[model samples]
Target: MTDQLTYLLQKLDASAHRYAELDKYYEGRQPLAFLSPEARTALGSRFGRMASNIPRLAVTALAERLRITGFSDPALWADWVRCDLDQTSGTAHREALLLGDAYVIVWADRLGRPAVSVESAKQVTVMTDPGTRQITAAVKRWEDRIAKTSTAVLYEPDRITRLVANQIGAVGSGFKVVDEIANPLGTVPVVRLHNSDRILDRHWHSEFDGRGHSEIDDLIPLVDALNKSLADLMTTSEYVGRPRRWATGIELTEEPVLDEDGNETGETVEVNPLPESHRMMISESPDSKFGQLQAADLQGYEASVRVILGQIMAVSTLPAHYVGVFTDNPASADALRAAEASLTARAEARQATFGRSWEQVAKLMIAVRDGRDPQLIDDVRVQWADAATRSVAQEADAVVKLHQAGLLPVSTALAKLGYSADEIAEIRVARRAEALDTAGLDLGRPA
Candidate 1:
């Protein structure tokens, strides 16, 4: 047991470091940290400070655009899960989009109302059984910087426990468990949300077990190049525009002159080809012309920037138009679809992983709210929104065709077209009422 705990602690420490590195990249800091000291010095502070943050932007864009298309929004779950989600601010969706690894901890608030909140990756570490890949435990450690203390919550299958320590070692260091307590929540109250699963030679690892790769991993180099290029351009522009003043073959002499009192008075006089002046004073010699610094070719820098952006678009699988660059003509609908195919596929893949986590969250929420066994709510599933862009008319037409051809039911078709269960039910009720009113009028019978 001690050896197992030590190994888990070591893994947690490594994960913390990995998470911190990812966070730094996402926040656009330390872009040139990997460079050697000599190389970094050569780049200077301006280049070091210039961060395009394209990687961050690309990842955020994908996460934001990958909307949750569907979930347990039917009438069966209206009171149990949907209402609770509304009260909790739809945390599952928000957390899934922002954090690659999201955790939901369920508990009852002071008023005994079931509550759920997203936990930061820094504070939560998940432990899973290697064979079954089932979460065996989840440990949450938080430190009070001001109080010089730390607290850890350990959630297991049969119980929820707390550990308090006066001082906790850095990530991998084993902490002294000074105190422990079991909580009222009998079962593990946390669920791990992974953006994607990692595979290894027919074996699978949870996102928590390994370092999760970000969507913008391939675009980091392009972003760095773009920023460096921009910094160089700015420096060149400053040098070219700097104030220039020069003087040559000029001399100053002090001459004695008689003042009004007939006493000797001295005054400095310019004894050169040109008068002393703040402006560029040209000398009489033909070889002494005013020198001017030529500006660098800004067009070249602009072209390089465009090329870097193109590379980002290609590697990230994002559309050129979406990245703020466009051709003379608007892209056709088919072209647009083709361009977004890769991005849509990536979003769908994320949905597959994140969807399951959401299902677990829904189950936990139901358990907390109704005091039912979470394991019993196994049928909960997530519905993701359409990953592709389509016009409203196109979507509605497709759904109507499917419904008329008997390929899909009206309710299902409406749901696929992004209609909520409540809206679909209301539409059906209104249609029935109109039919009844028309029959009562007897307009078809008489006319």
Candidate 2:
């Protein structure tokens, strides 16, 4: 038991290092310390933080579109809402997208109802079986700064042990057992929601288990480039993006100096009458005509920034417009669909992978609530909101054609038309009532 707790704590610390770095970028904290003070001055405050939020944008653009509507099991779906999975899942999903994986811990509340909560990767880490990818042991560690104490919870397949240390840094020295809880589910109650949880295709992910690929990891470099270019542009605008007027034959007029008491002094002083950054310049000689030094050509810097954005698009499933590149005229419906094809595909992939994890979570919730076999809810399925961007006419036309062709069922057609579950149920009831009324009437003879 001691050896297992020690190993899990080590793993927790290792994972925290990576999570810290990712969290910094996701929160718009620039990783690079500028070499020059001017660059910092230009991009250090509000504008800089805003420009560095590209990584944040990349993660959220897809996350916001992915919503879990319902579960296939009606009773489970009802329980899902009662458990407040809607709000908790929103927070968990976005964090998963940002940090690669987020865990949901299931337990029973005081009311004997299933309680679900999201744990961030920063504070939680788990060791998974290599073949099954099921968590063998998990630990969540947190420090109470005010009390100068740290607490760690180790979650195993059969038991949950809570341990504590004197200080956050002393977690390695050892911890005394503070509490323990029984988990009879025979599996860990924590379920992981992953973003791009694929094996190592590139150098981005670890070859080991218990980790998933982050959504913004690869985009961080591009985000840095974008921020760098933006800082440069802003610096240029502050230094030279504005027009400067130069005079070839201006005279420095001399005036008698005045003493502090307003008495004239013998010394004469020369002062250039032109104010700094003034819009106009005046001189007595004809050669004094002002020649303006045009503002710096920003196309190069902006083009470089756009090139970085283009590279991001090339590597990821994001489209050009998602990164803020826009055209003079709005894209045609077909063009917009074509552009967002990859994005939609990515969202679907998330729905598929995340759906499986959610199923596990639902099973855990039920098992915690009713002490029943999870396999009883084997028919569980995740219902995702439509991620496609289509016009109203287009959706209606496709739904009508598919339903008439017998390719899509009426219930499915209503779903395609963006009807909610409750709305569709109401529609079906109304239809049934209308059918009964028609059957009772003598329409054939009256018409």
Candidate 3:
């Protein structure tokens, strides 16, 4: 059952992706609004009259053909919400999704004045029977056509409470996203795509066994299952593609800002003395040290791996030993611990403050000494990842790299690194030109 579930999920996911691709290509090339009346007539004449009652294709039907029943429409959303809600209790459960009553108000004037007076309000409720748990939605529309502006809600016991917590995290916490996985079925594809972030190593495992009993008895196997799922799906999809043009490497190689004696003068953030050719393009070359490397080259992967290693290395630092050593000791351990602590502090600060930690800082520091802000290094990684995901072909693996490294926020990270958003945009354009040049393709031809 599990194996079958996994296979079905993969098929569904792949099918959905194919459909999305078709939708995008069709939408771009053929816009309903852009069609002239003559063209419309011509098409109609050729293909017969358009059906007014062209039935909406059921997602289940689509998924069935694609072999992805688990991810089909109401089944996907309903199961996802249910699984997610099951993880919470009390307020969290309520806040995540609430079910209650909502009133739809309509204004009407019987006397024929400038505005309509209050006519009537209809009460709507989403309720589930305690005995049967058969959920039903009840709504009373004012007119035969039903009020278009009417608002309806489900009275899930705990959604509102969860929403409040999420709101607080968004406002008070510096982090941008707080994601959790709730997998009711182990072999589902949506769980993999919706959660399993590569950087954080977060994935979903069934909380209960196949028979619906708690599977938390041994946490190891569950965690291993989740990890295995992530590993399997790691390189299957790309959110964006790499640039199309050939990149001849960065210019401005003379170290532009050197003094008469050629000693380092400006701060790390100071403009690189190199000309346009040597200028760093975060979008093209996220690993600043190797600006023009191909996406196929292991440079990005190696760089990301190094960043993760750095964080892991930093974890070895101990504060207690470093804080009290004073005798005529070599203090090698203390020194190492302090350095690690500094790195750890910086990483934790970045993660806690913004949900993203600078995994590329150590790699960038190797390119130039004096410890530049990890934000700058991170920005370059993100921009490159974004470019790859957005531009590269769907089959390309660049999207997987970006998604795995959690480097999609390159522009924002660059902004934090002291580059204005506009400057970053210009840099992206230039980098895109280089990548496209390298790939022997044109960047401006539409997308």
Candidate 4:
């Protein structure tokens, strides 16, 4: 189970990366649809042809790779897509709950009142003295009343015993503890509700809406509604049609002047300082925008992925969505297939690398710990050198760029070869000294 779960996480990570890649490719969009002739013409035939399939291919491929249920079920997958769109629109509405309390129906005749006499009234109270505090509650009734009403008391020992005994029956050996006024230690009793039949006449309704409604019915619509709501909210949430990326309000409307005369000069212009009202406003905060988008995407993506993976793990057969997915759009179909392949490869590679690296790091640590482990140190050093060479070859440009930036940690150079922290630190300390005659420092310069 752990291995399977780990595989799934790695798969999820790869799927996320692919999604991000495709998002960049298409500049963030949904699946394409059949364009009207005029719309296609305006976009140009090639543009219309390729551009339309981008989202479908990306999302479909990601789903297929994730092995979600809808992959085999087109209709179900379509619903899921609709679900995604619905969630994206962000129409969130709260659900209302029904609350109720337990009540009893008493017989007016038993209480010495005529059933037809509506004017007469009767009242009864149940009280319990817990020794620390006394709780009292009253039930009021009118003669000839046929409906039910509620009377609540603190859930004291007597009330609970009564409710339980009334509901379950007094047959079993049951006991309860009650607080005593004199002795703080408390007292126990083999007890039961005195008037079980009388109490049983009342029905206990959950105080909150306890209607057993299908969550699927509620959740699907809710997610769709939330997406719609979000779409509407976004349109009004921020400054729309502003020229500057992060500019808002008057600052966006105001033009910069090159000179005091306000002439249209080619020289650099100094814009007026932002007004007080919009002073703190920014056109866009990359961090905030990125974070929000990521969070929203994460929620929907995670839910969809979980559902898909669950189906894949449970069923021996693939869903119809998986088959119909190919027919949806060719480009997307290809992408989806590729995404599936990519996810599997990534998961396998991550598992293999993690295990291998952990072992290498451990061995290096042991080698550095004591001076007599030269062979072990040499073996690990050889492995690190081979890995480094492959890494450089795979992405030399990225490596050079990273080296140029101070962003790469000082420890990275020492640790990149898979040395343990202590091992790396010991090397650094020894290297800085005048001369290292120590046994641990002679790894022959980290390759």
Candidate 5:
């Protein structure tokens, strides 16, 4: 038991650094950390850790779109509501997007219902079976940095074990079993929300044990480039973006004398120093003529910024508008839809993956409710809200066009426009009643 717990703890310790680093990037602190001391001086003391934060925008855009409205089963949906998952699940989704993984732990509460807890990747780690890719063991671990102690719970197929060790962040810190419970649930109750998980054949994240990847991996380099461009622009604006004035022929003399009695104190200075360029600086000398130094052309800097932003948009799968990029011309409907295509595809992909994990959570909740493993409700499905980006008017117009072309029935068109089954049923009943009323009125009128 000691050896097994030690192994999981060691794995968790190894992964914690990665989780913290990703979190820093998602919070917009990573780019500025790389700023050289000279760059910081150039940026000014007032500016500390300022960057574009487009990575956060990218992560947030996808996380907000992956909404779980409910489950297909009423009982499961009810359980979800009881757990307040509709609100709490957003945290889980965001953490997964930021950290490459998140965890949902389900256990029986005192009320005989499932209790749900959300955990960041730093707090949890799992051992997966190579052939089946199933979690054979999982751990939720916590540490007190000041106290230098670690407390953890390990979930295996047939038992739950709690272990604690002092001298955390040290080598060979042994963990002793503090408590144990036999598992009647028959399987691990921890569900992982792993972002960008890839099959071993196609996996590229060899650095972190070939585990799941994250949006940060694609965004960080782009963000750094973008920040560099922004910083350059700022520097140019501060020092050399605008024109400087020169007056070589000016006869301005250096003399200064000031006292209450008008005595010469002999502190020499330019007779009339250069005034702000916003106003005229007329020299008294007949030959005095002002020449302007050419300002640095900022167009190229702006173009570089846009180019880096384009790269960011491409890598993050975010539309231009999401990163606050837009053209002089208002975006056409087709253009808007085209821009959102990749983003919509990414959201749907997440739904398909995160939905599987949510389904397992529902099953685990059912296990808690029934006091046994949920082998019966294997077909549980998660109902996700539509992540497609389109205005209602546009969708309605498309539906009408499809109906007019005889390509889609009214019901199917309504479904395409995101009507629920119950809402469609109600509409059908109301339409039938209206038709009957019209027929009765026609019969009574003159036929």
Candidate 6:
């Protein structure tokens, strides 16, 4: 038991560090410290200053795009879990996208009714068995600064252990077990939703197994470059507008002055310096031809920044037109579709991983509500919104063609055209009602 607790504590600390690193990037802070002056300025004479500015544009853009393309629709699956999700603030999906993972904890409320809630990665950590790669326990650690206390809720397969510590850092107070309750679900009540998965011996193999990488990791360099390029451009602009100059044939003059006591005092000196503002400085001779320091050609820097942004889009699988400014005509539908193909693929990949977690959450909700194991709800699947960018006319034509070819039913085609199951069912019922009304007969009456 001691070993297990120690292992979980170690894993929790590691996960916390990973989360902090990712969070730093998300918050527009540099995750890595600037290199030493000796290393960065090795070839100092010719090169410019080190690019140390931290910009969050790439992280912000990637995260926003992922949230829009990945989890814009929370209740994509059209199931009982949707109800539970709706009961929350409807930010569970957004949290998952931002944090790379989110947690759902299922339990019974005061009325003994099943309830579900979301937990950010910062507050929750999970420990998985090495051999099975299955979650053995989950911990919810939170600090109450106002109350000057820290609480840890350890959820195991059969029971929940709540531990409280008076001082925050003094974990040695040894988590005093305040309460223990039997887990009715008979399994870990927490489900982990991951953004992506990694292979074994790798970082992220299972749902609760790894610290999934955030979408912003790859775009950090590009974002830094973009910011630096912009800074250089601004510097160039300032230099061009107010060129620096040097004054020549100017000398300092000193003259002795009388003091208040009528005695010879220190000499008063006059030192003439070049004008500091953006005005012409008068020179004594034609030899002093106000020379301007060469301002960098900003065109190259601007173009390089654009290129970096393009690379960011390409590597992140986001559409170029979406992130970059478009001066030319808007891209055609086919062109747009081609551009978004990679983004669609990425969204699909995320769906596959997050979907399983949603399924588990749904099953847990069912188990809580019905007092059943919910093993029968295996078929409960997540319904993802269409990730592709297509015009309505194009989608309608394709659906029509599929229906004409007898490859899909009309209802199924409509569903494929982005209609939810509930909406489709309602449409079908309305059509049936209209048909019955047209027949001028009530099915309940014996006409």
The TM-score values for the models, in the order shown, are 0.73, 0.83, 0.14, 0.15, 0.79, 0.74
How well is each residue in 110-216 modelled by candidate 2, as lDDT tens digits? 98788888898877777777687668888788889999888888889889988899876445457889899887777877888877655532333544354667888
Give per-residue CA lDDT, model 3, range 350-423, as digits (tens).
22321111112122221223223322433322111120111234323544556468885665444434343346
Please write out the lDDT profile of model 4 over residues 277-334, one tens digit for every residue: 5536444435432111211223453355344433432231222244233333325444
Compose the digit string of candidate 1's lDDT tens values, residues 288-403: 64554554567888888889888888888777776777662236766767777887877777777777776776777666666788777667877766877777887888889989
Give the Å shift of residue 386 in candidate 6.
1.4
Candidate 1 at 342: error in angstroms?
Answer: 0.5
Q: State model 3's lDDT.
A: 0.27
Model 4, clash count? 34
Writing each residue's lDDT as its tens digit, candidate 6 over 82-177 gives 444633423555556656668888887776666777888787768777887677888888888998887888899989988888866324246788
The CA lDDT of each predicted structure is 0.64, 0.77, 0.27, 0.29, 0.78, 0.64
Location of the lowest summed lDDT over 10 successive residues in candidate 5:
201-210
- What TM-score does candidate 4 reach? 0.15
Error of 2 at 361 (Å): 0.9
Model 5: pairs clashing at backbone N, Cα or C within 3 Å: none
Clash pairs, model 1 backbone: 68-385, 69-384, 69-385, 70-383, 70-384, 71-383
Compared with the true structure, the alpha-carbon lDDT of candidate 2 equals 0.77
Segments of candidate 2 deviating more than 4 angstroms: 31-52, 169-173, 200-210, 248-271, 277-289, 328-330, 375-379, 405-409, 426-447
RMSD of 1: 7.3
- The parts of candidate 6 lying over 4 Å away from their true place are 1-3, 31-98, 169-173, 201-209, 240-295, 325-330, 403-411, 425-447
For candidate 4, the 10 contiguous residues with the lowest summed lDDT are 91-100
Cα RMSD to the true fold for all candidates: 7.3, 4.5, 33.2, 32.5, 5.7, 6.8
